[model samples]
Target chain A: MLRYLAKKLITLVALLFFVSITVFAVLFVLPGDPAQIILGINATPEALAALRADLGLDKSFWGQYREWVGNLLAGRSHHSIHYKMPVFDLIVDSLAVTGPMALMAMGFAVLISLPLGIYAARNQNRHGDVTVMFFTQLGLATPEFWFGILLILLLSVQLGWFSAGGFPGWAADPIGAFKALLLPAFALGVIRAAILTRLTRSSMLEVLREDYVRTARAKGLRERSVIYVHALRNALIPVLTIMGLQLGQLLAGAIIIENVYFLPGLGRLVFNAIGQRDLPVVRDIVLFMAAAVVVVNFVIDVAYAYVDPRIKIN
Target chain B: MNTPLLGIEELSVGFDTPEGKARAVDRVSFALERGETLGVVGESGCGKSVTALSILGLVPSPPGVIESGAIRFENSDLIGSPPEALRRIRGRDIAMIFQEPMTSLNPVLPIGRQVAEPLMVHRGLNRKEALDQAAQWLERVKIPDARRRMGDYPHHLSGGMRQRVMIAMAMVCRPKLLIADEPTTALDVTIQAQILALMVGLKQEMGMSLLLITHNLGVVAQMAARVVVMYAGQVVEEAVVSELFGRPFHPYTRGLLRSMPDPAGRPDGGSRRLSEIPGIVPAITEAIVGCKFAGRCPHAFGRCREQAPGLFDIAGGQRARCWLSRFPERRRTDA
Candidate 1:
């Protein structure tokens, strides 16, 4: 198992390297001037040249690439021309809002969908099954931004249960921050829960038909225990696969929902950085998203080993 | 032998398909006495397994239902019993083990949990106590290092060992009746003998009645006291194991016996071709007015095609469903 994890770790590093290079190449070719965006029209040529040199914007393409790589390896971050702060600190601040929201959305998805899916599969073709399927279909159909707007309208605008948008700092007041993030988290979570429930239902249908489930019933286990303990645990490998993919999607897909809720997040930072031609932040954050996906996939592979002992990691 | 432990009266289990109702088990009736092993024998699709499933209340319902029947166990009718009542009886008064040992257990759960399930359910023992008792049961089933092996998953054990674990799980609660459906069909030849021996040994040790269902006549001879011979969803004949082997009354039973190639019976002391029953076990999707096995019975006659034969007693608790065994004057008898 250790050897398998070590191999995956090496692959993850290689993949991150490839992703960083791709992000750098794509950003380099885009038509933009960071110095121009930072200095504005009133700046003199001398001031602009000094600013360009200081920012490393005046270096050759390869020279700038080498400097970025060196700074990354040495644990230093270039100053963000847009934020006027260290890029690391800015990225971390944005993620503080985005990370919890994504995790909360994920927890909501698992808690809601796992049972819904299993219940639908068990009831299968009855009224309960049809109702759950109908809602999941509707959830899958609606867009995340539209869902977010709908939640804002219902909870924030109409009910006045929550403020309309913008995050209060978590460190300032944990409860208020949770309340502020709830609507947006639920909004992002609905579509994922819909997709996950469908996957869970189908996967559960297959596992429920397995011979082992019959034996479980023959043991006189309660129908509920048979479905949840025996059937659900076996059905998890496939559901977990879909969940791991959805997590990376949540992290990257946060941009639109974050925009809708006015929640400060990394996706938004990357979006604004792209328009401002802030090279360091854009490249780093994109790399981070790809790394997030790769890391999540690796963790999922390990989880598979736990769910099914028959799976040999090697 | 006088008082029966389980009695199935005119049980008809069918499935609803697009075309019509598919009668998988047609009006099957039989009885098993206390501490007796009654073997239900037939070809692969002959409804032997269905009968067992129906008794255990495990058959899938929408497509499958008990069209008509009564299953009397311990003075209570199990056929239409409430789920709560059935749940209480199942694995406490009665328990079942299936054919595929390798697949009949949860692959993820530890073996200890699977063995202790019945004890926890029926006995209401706590997890730790149940597990301790489960370890002892595993030891009785001859699993080495029983306590330590409790942590192993189903996939970690060999097929024979898995079957032994399945047996351990089935017997943990000391059920009054134990139904084993083709329990040894999927094992190595030598391992088959050992598992069958272990089952018989366990039955004797616990003094519990056993319903041993198998297609193998050889297996029935070793494990069963009396045997019910089924053909195309109906019981064609039933007798003491020796009586059925010595003199098979129905043509179907005769064909089943002839199909087995005996080395001692070979002509000129050399190998010879084994006789086979000509036709497969046919399905019952449409209405039937005559004997279901008449098409495959070599001695099928004019009356055999016109009406189903009733089970008639020949002697000493022996019964065969055939017109040829009855007097030529006998007619219109139905069971």
Candidate 2:
């Protein structure tokens, strides 16, 4: 296990390096001048040149990339032109919203999917299964942002159940913070639950038919034990695989939903940074997103190994 | 006769498919006496496993339903019993092992935990106590270093060892009946013999009735006192093991016997092509009006094709479902 962890850690570093390169390369190819944008459009060429030199934008692409990476590692980092703070600190603030919202969305999804999926699977072909399936189909068909908008309209606008959008600082009022994010989190969570419910249902359906489940039943185990204990664990392996992939998706998917909710998440930060042409913030935020994806996938692999001992990490 | 431990009467199981309801076990009836081994022998898809699965009420529904039946165990009706009632009887009063040991046990669970599950569920033992008892079961099944081996997953065990674990699990509750559905089919020949031996030993030691379901005639010959032969969905014949082997009255039974490879070399000393039953078992969905084995039976007469024969007593505690068996009435008169 230690060897597996060490191997994963090494890959994580290499993956981060690759992600940094991709982010840098894409930004390098974009037709814009970061220094000029940071300075004003009416700024003199001398001022622009001095800003470029100060920012090290005049250096070769590879040379600039190495120095940027080295500085990031060495604790010397670039500041966001728009935010007027270090890029690292700017991203941390963005993540503060993104992390909680994503987790709450996923937490809600799992809460809904696990029971709904298991219930649907157990009552296969009955009204319970059909109804859940029909709702899931509707959930799957609706775009997450559209779903969020519909949620906002129904819950916040119509019923006044929750605030429409925006993140209240968690430290301010914990109850209010949760209530504020609830609608968006639910909006994000419902669509995921739709996909995950179907996944869990089918996976559970297959596991329910396995011989061990039969053996479990033969042992006169209660229906609950047979379904939840024996069948669910085996079914969970596949569901968990998708769940890992889905977590990363929820983060990326938060981009659109964040816009819809007016939430000050990384997605919004990236949107604003790109519009302002704050090269450092955009690059840093996107790099963080990429790193997040890599890290999520690594955690998933570790989790899969823990759930299913058959998985041997090389 | 002593009261049968389990009496299955007119039990027919059918699975609903897109096409229609396909009957898998058609009005199959059998009685298992206490401490007696009953071998149910048939080819693949002949409903051998389904019969065993139905006994536990473990056949997955929506697709499967007991069309009509009575499964009486300990004076209680098991068929259409409440889920709680069935669950109480299952794994407690009766336990079952399956055909494929490779997939029969939970892969993620420790072999010990799986073996101990029955004890925990039925015996009301705590986790620590149940697991300790599970180690004893493993040791009983002759798993070496049973205590230390408790933590290893199913993947760590060999095929035969896994089957032994399965047997251990089934017998852990000291169930009145242990239904082993082709438990040794997935193992090598030597391992198959060992598993069979182990099961028989466990059955005798536990004083449990054994329902050994297998397609192998030799396996039946070795382990069973009475043999019930099923073809397609019907019970084609039933007799004492020696009597069934000595004189198989049904043509399908005769075909099965002929198909068995000769353990002792033929006089010519060269391997001969083994005789096959000639035709595949009819698919259950196809509406067949006659004997399921007629197309495969060489002696299938006009009556065999036009209608199915009911089980007929062929004298001396043997019975066969065949038109030929009916002729014995006139033969006895002529004699």
Candidate 3:
């Protein structure tokens, strides 16, 4: 098991390395003059050159990469041109807003999807299944941004139930922050819940047809226990895969959602940085997101091993 | 006959398909004495498995409707029992071991948990106690290293081992009637023999009646005392095992017997040709004004094509559904 874990760790490191290099290369390939953007359109070429040197853009590509990787290893922070602060500090500040929202949204998604998905699978081909599936199809097709906008229009503008956009410090007033986050979280979570519901339904349907499920029934277990305990565990492997992938998407997707809500989050920070061509900030955040994805996936893999004894890491 | 552990009277199962209402089991009736082994032999889609499922009320009700039936177990009708009541009776009184052991045992759960599930549900035993009993049952089934192996998942076991685990699971509750549907079909010849022997031993030890559903005549000869031959959703022939093999009155039974490959009757010294049953079994969807096997039976006559023959007693404890058996003069000699 230790050897298997070591092997997985090595593979994870390799994957992170590949992801970092690819992201770095892609960001550089995009046609953008960060120095000119920083200096302003009316600024002279000498000012631009000075800014480029200062930003390490004047250095060789490999030299810059080596310096970036070395600085990351040494915990040397990058300055965010947009925020005029350390990239780390900006990320921490944004995370304070985005982290709880993402967590709460995922929690809501799971709470809504689990029972609905199980119900759809159990009452497969009935009115319940059809209705849930129809809504799920709509959810998967409609983008989160559009859904967010719709929620803002319907619940905030017309209904007067929530604030239009912006995060109130939840620390100062927990109830106010909760009320503020609820609509945005619900908007994002509904789409996720819809996707997860579909996945859970399909996976559970397949699992229910398996011989073990029949065996469970034959064992005189109540229908509920048979469906929930025996069937759900086996079905969860596929659902977990989709959920892990979506977690990465949630982080990336939060950018748009955060922007729409005008919430201060890593997503909005990244979006603002991209618009201003803050390459250092962009590079750092992209790398951080990549790392987050890898770590989340690793946790999911470990969780799978715990849930299914048949899944030996080796 | 010890009040007959299980009795089925006028049992009929029909399904509402896209075509129409198609009867799967048409007025099929049989009795199983306590500790008796009744082998139900049939071709694919011949309603053998459906009959077994019906006994435990496991058949899906909407598509599969019990048109008419009384499945009496321990002097109580199980036909219309509530789902909750059925749950109590299912693993406690009537247990079933399904085909495809690999898929039948939940791949996610440990074999011990699968086996002990019935005990936990019916007996209300906690996990530790249930697991202890499960390990004992595994040992009873001759699974090596039962204690250690209890933690192993279904996929960790071989096909035969998995089937044994399934059998152990079914028998753990000491059900009065154990239904094994093609239990050994997924196994190789050697493992098949071992599993059959193990089932026989377990049945004898527990004094449990067994309803063995299979397409193999050899299995009937080895394990069963009485045999029911099914063809096209009907019981074509039923007789004492020895009598059924000695004198198969139904054409389907005769065809099945003849089709068994005999190693001693090899044309080449080492290889034998399997006797083939010429025509395919008729589809259930086909309109049946006459006998279901009439289209395929070599001994089918004019009346056989026009009128369906009800099961009639041919001799003591032997019944056959065939026009030729009734009127020997009308039997075809061509084949």
Most accurate candidate by DockQ: 2
Chain B global fold similarity (TM-score) for predicted model 1 against the true chain B:
0.95
How do the residues A1-314 of candidate 2 rate in per-residue lDDT, one tens digit apiece?
78877887888788878888988898888888987787778999999999889888889998889888888899876888877889878777777778888889899999999999999998998999999999999989989998888888998899998888877778888888778778888888889999999999999999988888878888888778888889998999989888888788667537888899888888888988888888888877777777788788988887888788788776
Q: Pick the candidate with the highest TM-score.
A: 1
**How would the candidate models be sorted by TM-score, starting from the highest?**
1, 2, 3
lDDT string for model 1 (A1-314, tens) is: 78987898899889988887888888888986677778897888888899889888788888988899888889898778778798889878988888888888999999889989989998999999999999999999999899999888988899999989988888988888888888888987888999999999999999998999999889888888898889999999889988999888777648888888888888789888899998888887887788789888888888898888888898
Isolated chain A TM-score, each model:
0.95, 0.94, 0.93
Q: Which CAPRI quality tier does the interface of model 3 achieve?
A: medium
Docking outcome class, model 1: medium
Give me the runs in candidate 2 sitting further than 4 Å from their true place: A158-161, A172-174, A251-253, B266-273, B328-335
How well is each residue in B1-335 modelled by candidate 3, as lDDT tens digits? 36688998889999988988888988898899999999999988999999999988888766899889799998889997888898899899999998899889888888888888888899989999999999999999989999999989988999999998998899888999999999998899999999999999989998999999999888989999999998878888999998999988888888898889775765567765566778787667778889888888787778888999999999988999888767987766665
Can you give the DockQ of every candidate in the order shown?
A: 0.79, 0.83, 0.72
Model 3, residue B15: what's the lDDT? 91
Better of 1 and 3 by lDDT: 1
Worst 10 residues of 2 chain B by lDDT: B326-335
Model 2: docking quality category: high
